[model samples]
Target: MNGILFEKMRFTCQQSGHCCCDPNIIVTLTYRDLLRLFTTLYCDFRLLLQKISFYTLDSTTSPILEKQMVLETILTSDGKVIPGLKKHSKKICVFYSRPSCSIYSSRPLACRNYPLAFVKEKELIMSTWVKNSPKTCPGIGKGSPLSQKNIEQRGKRFFKEIEKHNQVVRELNVEASNNRPLTAREALWTLIIYGESEYQQRQK
Candidate 1:
Protein backbone atom coordinates (compact mmCIF):
# COMPACT_ATOMS: atom_id res chain seq x y z
CA MET A 1 0.00 0.00 0.00
CA ASN A 2 1.32 3.46 -0.94
CA GLY A 3 0.54 5.16 2.34
CA ILE A 4 0.73 8.85 3.25
CA LEU A 5 1.80 10.10 6.65
CA PHE A 6 -1.18 10.99 8.83
CA GLU A 7 0.46 14.20 9.98
CA LYS A 8 0.60 15.51 6.44
CA MET A 9 -3.10 15.01 5.74
CA ARG A 10 -6.26 16.98 6.49
CA PHE A 11 -9.86 15.79 6.39
CA THR A 12 -13.36 16.54 7.64
CA CYS A 13 -16.47 14.88 6.30
CA GLN A 14 -18.40 17.04 3.88
CA GLN A 15 -21.56 15.07 4.67
CA SER A 16 -22.70 15.00 1.06
CA GLY A 17 -23.58 11.31 1.62
CA HIS A 18 -21.85 10.52 -1.68
CA CYS A 19 -19.64 7.82 -0.16
CA CYS A 20 -22.63 6.07 1.39
CA CYS A 21 -24.43 6.18 -1.96
CA ASP A 22 -21.48 5.30 -4.17
CA PRO A 23 -22.31 2.39 -6.41
CA ASN A 24 -18.66 1.55 -7.03
CA ILE A 25 -17.90 0.83 -3.39
CA ILE A 26 -18.96 -2.32 -1.53
CA VAL A 27 -19.14 -1.79 2.23
CA THR A 28 -17.78 -5.05 3.59
CA LEU A 29 -18.34 -6.01 7.23
CA THR A 30 -16.24 -7.66 9.90
CA TYR A 31 -17.90 -9.72 12.64
CA ARG A 32 -17.68 -6.79 15.04
CA ASP A 33 -19.28 -4.53 12.49
CA LEU A 34 -22.14 -6.95 12.06
CA LEU A 35 -22.50 -7.24 15.83
CA ARG A 36 -22.64 -3.46 16.16
CA LEU A 37 -25.49 -3.36 13.69
CA PHE A 38 -27.24 -6.29 15.35
CA THR A 39 -27.34 -4.57 18.73
CA THR A 40 -28.01 -1.13 17.25
CA LEU A 41 -31.08 -2.46 15.51
CA TYR A 42 -32.33 -4.21 18.70
CA CYS A 43 -31.04 -7.73 17.84
CA ASP A 44 -33.20 -8.11 14.76
CA PHE A 45 -31.27 -10.80 12.93
CA ARG A 46 -33.97 -11.17 10.27
CA LEU A 47 -33.85 -7.46 9.55
CA LEU A 48 -30.05 -7.57 9.50
CA LEU A 49 -30.06 -10.46 7.05
CA GLN A 50 -32.24 -8.51 4.69
CA LYS A 51 -29.65 -5.71 4.62
CA ILE A 52 -26.70 -8.00 3.91
CA SER A 53 -25.44 -9.19 0.54
CA PHE A 54 -23.12 -12.12 0.22
CA TYR A 55 -20.75 -11.47 -2.67
CA THR A 56 -19.90 -14.79 -4.23
CA LEU A 57 -16.68 -14.98 -6.16
CA ASP A 58 -16.15 -17.10 -9.20
CA SER A 59 -13.56 -17.30 -12.01
CA THR A 60 -14.55 -13.82 -13.12
CA THR A 61 -13.22 -12.13 -9.97
CA SER A 62 -10.15 -9.98 -10.55
CA PRO A 63 -6.96 -11.50 -9.17
CA ILE A 64 -5.76 -8.23 -7.62
CA LEU A 65 -9.11 -7.55 -6.00
CA GLU A 66 -9.31 -11.06 -4.59
CA LYS A 67 -5.83 -10.76 -3.13
CA GLN A 68 -6.81 -7.58 -1.28
CA MET A 69 -9.53 -9.18 0.81
CA VAL A 70 -8.44 -8.89 4.48
CA LEU A 71 -10.78 -11.67 5.55
CA GLU A 72 -10.45 -15.21 4.30
CA THR A 73 -13.08 -16.29 1.78
CA ILE A 74 -15.76 -18.34 3.48
CA LEU A 75 -16.55 -21.71 1.93
CA THR A 76 -20.33 -21.69 1.98
CA SER A 77 -22.61 -24.16 0.24
CA ASP A 78 -23.68 -21.22 -1.87
CA GLY A 79 -20.07 -20.46 -3.01
CA LYS A 80 -16.99 -18.53 -1.80
CA VAL A 81 -18.60 -15.66 0.06
CA ILE A 82 -17.73 -12.20 1.37
CA PRO A 83 -20.46 -10.47 3.32
CA GLY A 84 -21.22 -6.81 2.70
CA LEU A 85 -24.07 -4.35 2.89
CA LYS A 86 -26.79 -4.93 0.32
CA LYS A 87 -27.43 -2.12 -2.06
CA HIS A 88 -30.84 -1.02 -3.24
CA SER A 89 -32.01 -2.01 -6.73
CA LYS A 90 -30.67 1.37 -7.79
CA LYS A 91 -27.28 0.41 -6.21
CA ILE A 92 -27.28 2.82 -3.26
CA CYS A 93 -26.41 1.52 0.23
CA VAL A 94 -29.41 0.03 2.01
CA PHE A 95 -28.78 2.11 5.14
CA TYR A 96 -28.49 5.31 3.15
CA SER A 97 -31.40 7.73 3.55
CA ARG A 98 -31.70 11.16 1.91
CA PRO A 99 -28.76 13.18 3.28
CA SER A 100 -26.99 10.71 5.57
CA CYS A 101 -26.56 7.18 6.75
CA SER A 102 -29.34 5.99 9.05
CA ILE A 103 -26.79 3.93 10.98
CA TYR A 104 -24.02 6.51 11.04
CA SER A 105 -23.11 6.02 14.69
CA SER A 106 -22.85 2.26 14.20
CA ARG A 107 -21.55 2.28 10.65
CA PRO A 108 -19.11 -0.44 9.68
CA LEU A 109 -15.35 0.07 9.94
CA ALA A 110 -15.21 0.33 6.16
CA CYS A 111 -17.36 3.45 6.43
CA ARG A 112 -15.82 4.75 9.67
CA ASN A 113 -12.35 4.64 8.09
CA TYR A 114 -13.48 6.21 4.86
CA PRO A 115 -11.26 8.49 2.72
CA LEU A 116 -8.31 6.79 4.46
CA ALA A 117 -7.01 3.25 4.42
CA PHE A 118 -4.68 2.04 7.16
CA VAL A 119 -2.13 -0.70 7.37
CA LYS A 120 0.43 -1.70 9.97
CA GLU A 121 4.08 -2.26 9.05
CA LYS A 122 6.28 -3.72 11.76
CA GLU A 123 5.51 -1.40 14.67
CA LEU A 124 4.26 1.57 12.66
CA ILE A 125 0.86 2.44 11.29
CA MET A 126 0.67 3.64 7.69
CA SER A 127 -2.17 5.48 6.03
CA THR A 128 -3.54 6.50 2.62
CA TRP A 129 -6.72 7.75 1.04
CA VAL A 130 -8.99 5.02 -0.30
CA LYS A 131 -8.27 4.65 -4.00
CA ASN A 132 -11.96 4.59 -4.93
CA SER A 133 -13.07 7.58 -2.89
CA PRO A 134 -15.09 9.88 -5.15
CA LYS A 135 -12.83 12.42 -6.84
CA THR A 136 -15.50 15.04 -6.21
CA CYS A 137 -15.37 14.39 -2.48
CA PRO A 138 -14.76 17.77 -0.85
CA GLY A 139 -13.26 16.40 2.36
CA ILE A 140 -10.02 15.07 0.95
CA GLY A 141 -7.77 18.08 1.51
CA LYS A 142 -10.02 20.28 3.59
CA GLY A 143 -10.41 21.03 7.32
CA SER A 144 -7.74 20.97 10.06
CA PRO A 145 -4.72 18.74 9.79
CA LEU A 146 -5.39 15.25 11.06
CA SER A 147 -3.96 14.00 14.35
CA GLN A 148 -1.40 11.25 13.94
CA LYS A 149 -2.07 9.84 17.39
CA ASN A 150 -5.79 9.63 16.69
CA ILE A 151 -5.15 8.02 13.29
CA GLU A 152 -2.85 5.42 14.85
CA GLN A 153 -5.38 4.61 17.56
CA ARG A 154 -8.11 3.99 14.99
CA GLY A 155 -5.78 1.97 12.80
CA LYS A 156 -4.72 -0.24 15.69
CA ARG A 157 -8.31 -0.80 16.81
CA PHE A 158 -9.33 -1.53 13.24
CA PHE A 159 -6.70 -4.24 12.83
CA LYS A 160 -7.43 -5.68 16.29
CA GLU A 161 -11.06 -6.24 15.31
CA ILE A 162 -9.98 -7.59 11.94
CA GLU A 163 -7.71 -10.13 13.66
CA LYS A 164 -10.58 -11.27 15.86
CA HIS A 165 -12.85 -11.57 12.85
CA ASN A 166 -10.19 -13.45 10.88
CA GLN A 167 -9.80 -15.97 13.67
CA VAL A 168 -13.51 -16.75 13.50
CA VAL A 169 -13.45 -17.18 9.72
CA ARG A 170 -10.35 -19.36 9.86
CA GLU A 171 -11.99 -21.71 12.36
CA LEU A 172 -15.19 -21.80 10.33
CA ASN A 173 -13.31 -22.59 7.13
CA VAL A 174 -11.40 -25.40 8.82
CA GLU A 175 -14.61 -26.87 10.19
CA ALA A 176 -16.26 -26.68 6.77
CA SER A 177 -13.33 -28.49 5.19
CA ASN A 178 -13.49 -31.19 7.88
CA ASN A 179 -17.28 -31.63 7.85
CA ARG A 180 -20.17 -30.40 5.75
CA PRO A 181 -19.83 -26.90 4.45
CA LEU A 182 -21.91 -24.15 6.04
CA THR A 183 -24.76 -22.33 4.36
CA ALA A 184 -24.46 -18.55 3.99
CA ARG A 185 -26.99 -17.99 6.74
CA GLU A 186 -25.21 -20.46 8.98
CA ALA A 187 -21.88 -18.73 8.55
CA LEU A 188 -23.47 -15.38 9.37
CA TRP A 189 -25.09 -16.74 12.49
CA THR A 190 -21.78 -18.20 13.56
CA LEU A 191 -20.18 -14.81 13.28
CA ILE A 192 -22.97 -13.14 15.20
CA ILE A 193 -22.77 -15.68 17.99
CA TYR A 194 -19.01 -15.41 18.22
CA GLY A 195 -19.10 -11.64 18.28
CA GLU A 196 -21.76 -11.57 20.97
CA SER A 197 -19.74 -13.93 23.14
CA GLU A 198 -16.68 -11.71 22.78
CA TYR A 199 -18.73 -8.67 23.66
CA GLN A 200 -20.06 -10.34 26.77
CA GLN A 201 -16.59 -11.38 27.84
CA ARG A 202 -15.43 -7.80 27.52
CA GLN A 203 -18.24 -6.65 29.79
CA LYS A 204 -16.90 -8.84 32.62
Candidate 2:
Protein backbone atom coordinates (compact mmCIF):
# COMPACT_ATOMS: atom_id res chain seq x y z
CA MET A 1 0.00 0.00 0.00
CA ASN A 2 1.20 3.54 -0.66
CA GLY A 3 2.22 5.37 2.54
CA ILE A 4 0.24 8.41 1.40
CA LEU A 5 -2.86 6.26 1.26
CA PHE A 6 -3.01 6.24 5.04
CA GLU A 7 -2.79 9.99 5.45
CA LYS A 8 -6.32 10.22 6.86
CA MET A 9 -7.84 10.86 3.44
CA ARG A 10 -8.52 14.54 3.93
CA PHE A 11 -10.94 16.64 1.81
CA THR A 12 -12.72 19.96 2.31
CA CYS A 13 -15.93 20.56 0.31
CA GLN A 14 -17.04 24.00 -0.87
CA GLN A 15 -20.32 22.64 -2.37
CA SER A 16 -20.19 25.05 -5.32
CA GLY A 17 -22.84 22.89 -7.08
CA HIS A 18 -20.58 21.02 -9.46
CA CYS A 19 -21.32 17.53 -8.09
CA CYS A 20 -24.91 17.95 -9.23
CA CYS A 21 -24.04 18.07 -12.93
CA ASP A 22 -22.33 14.74 -13.56
CA PRO A 23 -23.79 13.12 -16.69
CA ASN A 24 -22.63 9.51 -16.32
CA ILE A 25 -24.49 8.43 -13.22
CA ILE A 26 -25.90 4.86 -13.25
CA VAL A 27 -28.62 3.62 -10.89
CA THR A 28 -29.26 -0.11 -10.40
CA LEU A 29 -32.45 -1.52 -8.93
CA THR A 30 -33.53 -4.99 -7.76
CA TYR A 31 -36.46 -7.26 -8.69
CA ARG A 32 -37.86 -6.41 -5.29
CA ASP A 33 -37.34 -2.79 -6.20
CA LEU A 34 -39.19 -3.39 -9.42
CA LEU A 35 -42.15 -4.46 -7.36
CA ARG A 36 -41.74 -1.68 -4.82
CA LEU A 37 -41.63 0.91 -7.55
CA PHE A 38 -44.59 -0.51 -9.39
CA THR A 39 -46.57 -0.25 -6.21
CA THR A 40 -45.74 3.42 -6.21
CA LEU A 41 -47.04 3.69 -9.75
CA TYR A 42 -49.96 1.25 -9.77
CA CYS A 43 -50.67 1.75 -6.09
CA ASP A 44 -50.81 -2.01 -5.82
CA PHE A 45 -48.27 -4.69 -4.85
CA ARG A 46 -50.31 -7.81 -5.41
CA LEU A 47 -49.86 -7.52 -9.17
CA LEU A 48 -47.11 -9.51 -10.84
CA LEU A 49 -43.79 -7.62 -11.21
CA GLN A 50 -43.95 -8.09 -14.95
CA LYS A 51 -47.05 -5.97 -15.00
CA ILE A 52 -44.77 -2.94 -15.53
CA SER A 53 -42.68 -2.17 -18.61
CA PHE A 54 -38.93 -2.49 -18.17
CA TYR A 55 -38.04 0.48 -20.37
CA THR A 56 -39.57 3.18 -18.20
CA LEU A 57 -37.60 1.98 -15.15
CA ASP A 58 -34.36 2.45 -17.04
CA SER A 59 -31.54 4.79 -16.08
CA THR A 60 -32.10 7.08 -19.04
CA THR A 61 -35.73 7.56 -18.11
CA SER A 62 -35.52 7.65 -14.31
CA PRO A 63 -32.02 8.98 -13.65
CA ILE A 64 -32.72 11.22 -10.67
CA LEU A 65 -35.92 9.62 -9.45
CA GLU A 66 -34.12 7.95 -6.58
CA LYS A 67 -30.31 8.08 -6.40
CA GLN A 68 -27.47 8.85 -8.77
CA MET A 69 -25.99 5.54 -10.02
CA VAL A 70 -24.91 3.67 -13.12
CA LEU A 71 -26.71 0.46 -14.12
CA GLU A 72 -28.44 -1.16 -17.08
CA THR A 73 -31.80 0.22 -18.09
CA ILE A 74 -34.59 -1.92 -19.47
CA LEU A 75 -35.65 -1.26 -23.06
CA THR A 76 -39.41 -1.07 -22.65
CA SER A 77 -41.99 1.73 -22.69
CA ASP A 78 -44.22 1.01 -19.67
CA GLY A 79 -41.24 0.30 -17.38
CA LYS A 80 -41.33 3.93 -16.26
CA VAL A 81 -43.96 3.23 -13.62
CA ILE A 82 -41.40 1.54 -11.37
CA PRO A 83 -39.10 3.37 -8.93
CA GLY A 84 -35.97 3.46 -11.04
CA LEU A 85 -33.23 6.02 -11.41
CA LYS A 86 -34.52 9.50 -11.95
CA LYS A 87 -33.47 10.93 -15.30
CA HIS A 88 -30.55 13.28 -14.90
CA SER A 89 -31.45 16.91 -15.18
CA LYS A 90 -29.38 20.03 -15.78
CA LYS A 91 -29.93 20.19 -12.02
CA ILE A 92 -27.72 18.32 -9.53
CA CYS A 93 -29.43 15.41 -7.71
CA VAL A 94 -33.19 15.52 -8.40
CA PHE A 95 -33.46 15.34 -4.63
CA TYR A 96 -30.91 18.10 -4.21
CA SER A 97 -33.16 20.84 -2.95
CA ARG A 98 -30.68 23.70 -2.62
CA PRO A 99 -28.50 21.50 -0.33
CA SER A 100 -30.09 18.25 0.90
CA CYS A 101 -31.91 15.19 -0.42
CA SER A 102 -35.64 15.83 -0.87
CA ILE A 103 -36.61 12.14 -0.83
CA TYR A 104 -34.37 11.48 2.15
CA SER A 105 -36.80 9.00 3.71
CA SER A 106 -37.33 6.92 0.58
CA ARG A 107 -33.96 7.79 -0.95
CA PRO A 108 -32.28 4.87 -2.69
CA LEU A 109 -29.60 2.76 -1.01
CA ALA A 110 -26.90 4.55 -3.01
CA CYS A 111 -27.77 7.95 -1.57
CA ARG A 112 -27.47 6.70 2.00
CA ASN A 113 -23.90 5.69 1.13
CA TYR A 114 -22.75 8.78 -0.70
CA PRO A 115 -19.00 9.45 -1.17
CA LEU A 116 -18.62 5.65 -1.08
CA ALA A 117 -19.43 3.19 -3.85
CA PHE A 118 -18.72 -0.46 -4.61
CA VAL A 119 -17.33 -1.78 -7.88
CA LYS A 120 -18.48 -5.14 -9.25
CA GLU A 121 -15.95 -7.88 -10.10
CA LYS A 122 -14.90 -11.40 -9.12
CA GLU A 123 -13.98 -9.63 -5.91
CA LEU A 124 -15.77 -6.46 -4.85
CA ILE A 125 -14.01 -3.19 -5.56
CA MET A 126 -14.59 -0.02 -3.59
CA SER A 127 -14.12 3.47 -4.90
CA THR A 128 -14.12 6.88 -3.30
CA TRP A 129 -16.38 9.41 -4.96
CA VAL A 130 -14.56 12.08 -6.93
CA LYS A 131 -17.13 14.68 -7.88
CA ASN A 132 -15.64 15.86 -11.13
CA SER A 133 -12.80 18.41 -11.31
CA PRO A 134 -14.58 21.55 -10.06
CA LYS A 135 -17.15 20.33 -7.54
CA THR A 136 -16.95 20.17 -3.74
CA CYS A 137 -18.91 18.13 -1.17
CA PRO A 138 -18.70 18.96 2.52
CA GLY A 139 -18.92 15.33 3.57
CA ILE A 140 -16.20 14.25 1.15
CA GLY A 141 -13.67 13.53 3.92
CA LYS A 142 -14.89 15.31 7.03
CA GLY A 143 -17.03 12.70 8.76
CA SER A 144 -15.73 10.27 11.33
CA PRO A 145 -13.43 7.77 9.71
CA LEU A 146 -15.31 4.67 8.61
CA SER A 147 -13.39 1.56 9.65
CA GLN A 148 -12.67 -1.21 7.17
CA LYS A 149 -14.76 -3.52 9.30
CA ASN A 150 -17.69 -1.15 9.10
CA ILE A 151 -17.42 -0.80 5.35
CA GLU A 152 -17.09 -4.53 4.90
CA GLN A 153 -20.20 -5.08 6.95
CA ARG A 154 -22.09 -2.73 4.70
CA GLY A 155 -20.47 -4.29 1.65
CA LYS A 156 -21.70 -7.71 2.68
CA ARG A 157 -25.27 -6.52 2.81
CA PHE A 158 -24.87 -4.52 -0.36
CA PHE A 159 -23.52 -7.51 -2.24
CA LYS A 160 -26.29 -9.80 -1.07
CA GLU A 161 -28.93 -7.34 -2.19
CA ILE A 162 -27.19 -6.81 -5.51
CA GLU A 163 -26.94 -10.56 -6.05
CA LYS A 164 -30.67 -11.01 -5.73
CA HIS A 165 -31.14 -7.94 -7.88
CA ASN A 166 -28.81 -9.34 -10.52
CA GLN A 167 -30.64 -12.63 -10.52
CA VAL A 168 -33.90 -10.81 -11.14
CA VAL A 169 -32.34 -8.78 -13.94
CA ARG A 170 -31.05 -11.87 -15.65
CA GLU A 171 -34.47 -13.43 -15.47
CA LEU A 172 -36.10 -10.32 -16.82
CA ASN A 173 -33.51 -9.92 -19.58
CA VAL A 174 -34.02 -13.51 -20.63
CA GLU A 175 -37.79 -13.17 -20.58
CA ALA A 176 -37.61 -9.89 -22.45
CA SER A 177 -35.48 -11.31 -25.25
CA ASN A 178 -34.83 -14.81 -26.46
CA ASN A 179 -31.18 -13.82 -27.05
CA ARG A 180 -28.21 -15.19 -25.12
CA PRO A 181 -27.99 -14.28 -21.45
CA LEU A 182 -25.25 -12.04 -20.08
CA THR A 183 -22.42 -13.64 -18.12
CA ALA A 184 -22.77 -13.43 -14.32
CA ARG A 185 -19.63 -11.33 -14.07
CA GLU A 186 -20.86 -8.91 -16.70
CA ALA A 187 -24.34 -8.61 -15.25
CA LEU A 188 -23.34 -8.35 -11.61
CA TRP A 189 -20.49 -5.86 -11.62
CA THR A 190 -21.30 -4.18 -14.90
CA LEU A 191 -17.57 -3.17 -14.84
CA ILE A 192 -17.48 -1.52 -11.42
CA ILE A 193 -15.73 -4.47 -9.76
CA TYR A 194 -12.29 -3.47 -11.09
CA GLY A 195 -11.62 -0.92 -8.37
CA GLU A 196 -11.14 -3.24 -5.38
CA SER A 197 -7.43 -2.54 -5.09
CA GLU A 198 -7.96 1.16 -4.50
CA TYR A 199 -10.57 0.33 -1.90
CA GLN A 200 -8.35 -2.18 -0.07
CA GLN A 201 -5.27 0.04 -0.08
CA ARG A 202 -7.30 2.86 1.40
CA GLN A 203 -8.75 0.62 4.11
CA LYS A 204 -5.66 0.90 6.25
Candidate 3:
Protein backbone atom coordinates (compact mmCIF):
# COMPACT_ATOMS: atom_id res chain seq x y z
CA MET A 1 0.00 0.00 0.00
CA ASN A 2 2.21 2.82 -1.23
CA GLY A 3 0.52 6.12 -0.37
CA ILE A 4 1.13 9.54 1.13
CA LEU A 5 0.51 10.67 4.70
CA PHE A 6 -3.10 11.48 5.57
CA GLU A 7 -1.96 14.70 7.26
CA LYS A 8 -0.96 16.14 3.88
CA MET A 9 -4.25 15.51 2.15
CA ARG A 10 -7.51 17.43 2.14
CA PHE A 11 -11.03 16.31 1.15
CA THR A 12 -14.65 17.36 1.45
CA CYS A 13 -17.52 15.59 -0.29
CA GLN A 14 -19.30 17.99 -2.63
CA GLN A 15 -22.30 15.66 -2.54
CA SER A 16 -22.54 15.67 -6.31
CA GLY A 17 -23.43 11.96 -6.34
CA HIS A 18 -20.95 11.42 -9.14
CA CYS A 19 -19.59 8.28 -7.51
CA CYS A 20 -23.02 6.76 -7.26
CA CYS A 21 -23.95 7.75 -10.79
CA ASP A 22 -20.74 6.70 -12.47
CA PRO A 23 -21.39 3.50 -14.45
CA ASN A 24 -17.74 2.54 -14.55
CA ILE A 25 -17.45 2.46 -10.78
CA ILE A 26 -18.48 -0.74 -9.04
CA VAL A 27 -19.50 -0.53 -5.38
CA THR A 28 -18.28 -3.87 -4.04
CA LEU A 29 -19.62 -5.13 -0.72
CA THR A 30 -18.34 -6.73 2.47
CA TYR A 31 -20.60 -8.89 4.63
CA ARG A 32 -21.03 -5.99 7.03
CA ASP A 33 -22.24 -3.87 4.15
CA LEU A 34 -24.81 -6.50 3.24
CA LEU A 35 -25.80 -6.84 6.85
CA ARG A 36 -26.41 -3.13 7.15
CA LEU A 37 -28.53 -3.22 4.04
CA PHE A 38 -30.34 -6.26 5.30
CA THR A 39 -31.29 -4.56 8.52
CA THR A 40 -32.09 -1.25 6.81
CA LEU A 41 -34.34 -2.92 4.29
CA TYR A 42 -36.39 -4.67 6.93
CA CYS A 43 -34.35 -7.91 6.88
CA ASP A 44 -35.95 -8.95 3.62
CA PHE A 45 -33.59 -11.11 1.64
CA ARG A 46 -35.63 -10.65 -1.51
CA LEU A 47 -35.32 -6.89 -1.31
CA LEU A 48 -31.64 -7.12 -0.53
CA LEU A 49 -31.08 -9.37 -3.53
CA GLN A 50 -32.74 -6.83 -5.75
CA LYS A 51 -30.10 -4.22 -4.81
CA ILE A 52 -27.13 -6.45 -5.69
CA SER A 53 -25.55 -7.50 -8.97
CA PHE A 54 -23.08 -10.33 -9.46
CA TYR A 55 -20.15 -9.60 -11.76
CA THR A 56 -18.68 -12.74 -13.30
CA LEU A 57 -15.32 -12.99 -14.98
CA ASP A 58 -15.06 -14.96 -18.18
CA SER A 59 -12.52 -15.78 -20.91
CA THR A 60 -12.99 -12.35 -22.41
CA THR A 61 -11.75 -10.71 -19.24
CA SER A 62 -8.10 -9.72 -19.22
CA PRO A 63 -5.97 -12.13 -17.21
CA ILE A 64 -4.53 -9.39 -15.00
CA LEU A 65 -7.95 -7.95 -14.18
CA GLU A 66 -9.35 -11.41 -13.58
CA LYS A 67 -6.48 -12.24 -11.27
CA GLN A 68 -7.12 -9.08 -9.24
CA MET A 69 -10.83 -9.81 -9.03
CA VAL A 70 -10.23 -13.39 -7.88
CA LEU A 71 -7.91 -12.14 -5.16
CA GLU A 72 -10.30 -9.47 -3.91
CA THR A 73 -13.78 -10.66 -4.78
CA ILE A 74 -16.10 -13.56 -3.98
CA LEU A 75 -16.44 -16.93 -5.71
CA THR A 76 -19.60 -18.80 -6.65
CA SER A 77 -20.60 -21.53 -9.08
CA ASP A 78 -21.72 -18.89 -11.56
CA GLY A 79 -18.11 -17.63 -11.73
CA LYS A 80 -15.65 -15.52 -9.77
CA VAL A 81 -18.23 -13.13 -8.41
CA ILE A 82 -17.97 -9.52 -7.32
CA PRO A 83 -21.24 -8.69 -5.66
CA GLY A 84 -21.94 -4.98 -6.02
CA LEU A 85 -24.74 -2.49 -6.14
CA LYS A 86 -26.99 -2.95 -9.14
CA LYS A 87 -27.17 -0.18 -11.73
CA HIS A 88 -30.42 1.06 -13.16
CA SER A 89 -31.20 1.05 -16.91
CA LYS A 90 -29.38 4.33 -17.24
CA LYS A 91 -26.41 2.78 -15.45
CA ILE A 92 -26.63 4.81 -12.22
CA CYS A 93 -26.67 3.08 -8.85
CA VAL A 94 -29.96 1.49 -7.85
CA PHE A 95 -30.02 3.51 -4.66
CA TYR A 96 -29.34 6.79 -6.42
CA SER A 97 -32.40 8.95 -5.94
CA ARG A 98 -31.94 12.25 -7.73
CA PRO A 99 -29.05 14.02 -5.94
CA SER A 100 -27.98 11.46 -3.35
CA CYS A 101 -27.97 7.85 -2.21
CA SER A 102 -31.33 6.79 -0.81
CA ILE A 103 -29.64 4.58 1.76
CA TYR A 104 -26.83 7.02 2.53
CA SER A 105 -26.98 6.37 6.26
CA SER A 106 -26.19 2.68 5.74
CA ARG A 107 -24.10 2.92 2.60
CA PRO A 108 -21.20 0.48 2.25
CA LEU A 109 -17.76 1.23 3.67
CA ALA A 110 -16.38 1.65 0.19
CA CYS A 111 -18.82 4.46 -0.39
CA ARG A 112 -18.20 5.97 3.02
CA ASN A 113 -14.50 6.25 2.21
CA TYR A 114 -14.78 7.31 -1.36
CA PRO A 115 -11.90 9.16 -3.14
CA LEU A 116 -9.55 7.95 -0.39
CA ALA A 117 -8.27 4.44 0.19
CA PHE A 118 -6.20 3.39 3.22
CA VAL A 119 -3.93 0.51 4.19
CA LYS A 120 -1.63 -0.30 7.09
CA GLU A 121 2.10 -0.50 6.45
CA LYS A 122 4.58 -1.55 9.10
CA GLU A 123 3.70 0.81 11.96
CA LEU A 124 1.82 3.37 9.88
CA ILE A 125 -1.28 3.60 7.71
CA MET A 126 -1.07 5.04 4.19
CA SER A 127 -3.73 6.92 2.29
CA THR A 128 -4.29 7.37 -1.44
CA TRP A 129 -7.00 8.58 -3.77
CA VAL A 130 -8.94 5.68 -5.20
CA LYS A 131 -7.81 4.84 -8.70
CA ASN A 132 -11.31 4.63 -10.07
CA SER A 133 -12.64 7.87 -8.70
CA PRO A 134 -14.20 10.12 -11.31
CA LYS A 135 -11.85 12.66 -12.83
CA THR A 136 -14.36 15.38 -12.16
CA CYS A 137 -14.93 14.51 -8.51
CA PRO A 138 -15.37 17.89 -6.86
CA GLY A 139 -14.16 16.86 -3.42
CA ILE A 140 -10.56 16.08 -4.20
CA GLY A 141 -8.60 19.19 -3.19
CA LYS A 142 -11.27 21.65 -2.20
CA GLY A 143 -11.99 21.22 1.50
CA SER A 144 -10.27 21.72 4.86
CA PRO A 145 -7.19 19.74 5.74
CA LEU A 146 -7.97 16.12 6.73
CA SER A 147 -7.35 14.90 10.28
CA GLN A 148 -4.83 12.10 10.50
CA LYS A 149 -6.27 10.58 13.64
CA ASN A 150 -9.80 10.55 12.21
CA ILE A 151 -8.58 9.04 8.96
CA GLU A 152 -6.72 6.34 10.89
CA GLN A 153 -9.77 5.56 12.96
CA ARG A 154 -11.95 5.14 9.87
CA GLY A 155 -9.25 3.11 8.15
CA LYS A 156 -9.02 0.75 11.08
CA ARG A 157 -12.75 0.13 11.06
CA PHE A 158 -12.77 -0.26 7.27
CA PHE A 159 -10.02 -2.88 7.24
CA LYS A 160 -11.51 -4.71 10.21
CA GLU A 161 -14.79 -5.22 8.38
CA ILE A 162 -12.94 -6.25 5.25
CA GLU A 163 -10.88 -8.84 7.16
CA LYS A 164 -13.97 -10.46 8.65
CA HIS A 165 -15.65 -10.56 5.24
CA ASN A 166 -12.57 -12.06 3.61
CA GLN A 167 -12.46 -14.76 6.26
CA VAL A 168 -16.00 -15.80 5.46
CA VAL A 169 -15.26 -15.84 1.73
CA ARG A 170 -12.20 -17.98 2.27
CA GLU A 171 -14.25 -20.49 4.24
CA LEU A 172 -16.89 -20.61 1.53
CA ASN A 173 -14.24 -21.05 -1.18
CA VAL A 174 -12.76 -23.99 0.69
CA GLU A 175 -16.19 -25.57 0.94
CA ALA A 176 -16.70 -25.03 -2.79
CA SER A 177 -13.38 -26.63 -3.70
CA ASN A 178 -14.34 -29.61 -1.57
CA ASN A 179 -17.01 -30.60 -4.13
CA ARG A 180 -19.88 -28.64 -2.61
CA PRO A 181 -19.91 -25.46 -4.59
CA LEU A 182 -22.33 -22.69 -3.72
CA THR A 183 -24.48 -20.77 -6.15
CA ALA A 184 -24.34 -16.99 -6.08
CA ARG A 185 -27.64 -16.82 -4.23
CA GLU A 186 -26.51 -19.44 -1.73
CA ALA A 187 -23.26 -17.64 -1.10
CA LEU A 188 -25.08 -14.36 -0.44
CA TRP A 189 -27.55 -16.08 1.87
CA THR A 190 -24.66 -17.54 3.80
CA LEU A 191 -23.21 -14.08 4.25
CA ILE A 192 -26.54 -12.75 5.42
CA ILE A 193 -26.95 -15.50 7.98
CA TYR A 194 -23.40 -15.14 9.21
CA GLY A 195 -23.72 -11.37 9.49
CA GLU A 196 -26.99 -11.68 11.37
CA SER A 197 -25.47 -14.09 13.86
CA GLU A 198 -22.53 -11.78 14.45
CA TYR A 199 -24.84 -8.84 14.99
CA GLN A 200 -26.90 -10.82 17.50
CA GLN A 201 -23.81 -11.95 19.41
CA ARG A 202 -22.55 -8.39 19.61
CA GLN A 203 -25.77 -7.34 21.32
CA LYS A 204 -25.21 -9.77 24.20
Q: Best candidate, TM-score-wise?
A: 1
What is the per-residue lDDT of model 1 for residues 130-157, given as tens digits with 9 covering 90 to 100?
Answer: 8767485679888888998989998998
- Candidate 2: give its CA RMSD in angstroms: 11.2
- What ranges in model 2 sit over 4 Å off? 1-28, 32-84, 87-89, 120-127, 130-135, 179-204
Q: The CA-based lDDT of model 3 is what?
A: 0.83
* TM-score to native of every candidate shown: 0.95, 0.52, 0.92
> Candidate 3: deviation at residue 129, Å?
0.6
Tens digits of per-residue lDDT for model 2, 69-165: 3444432323422233544346345445666544445445554455455554567545455344324455556655666666656666777766655
Measure candidate 3: CA RMSD: 1.9
As a whole number from 0 to 100, the lDDT of residue 76 in candidate 2 is: 30
C-alpha lDDT score of every prediction, in listed order: 0.88, 0.45, 0.83
Colliding residue pairs in candidate 3: none
Candidate 2 Cα deviation (angstroms), residue 19: 4.4
lDDT of 3 by residue, 1-204 (tens): 468777777888999988888877888888888889989999999999999999877778888887554125566789878688899998999999988889999998889999888767675767888875637688888777799888888888877888788888998888888876889998888988899899899999
Candidate 2: 10-residue stretch with minimal lDDT: 187-196
Clashing residue pairs in all predictions, respectively, total 0, 25, 0
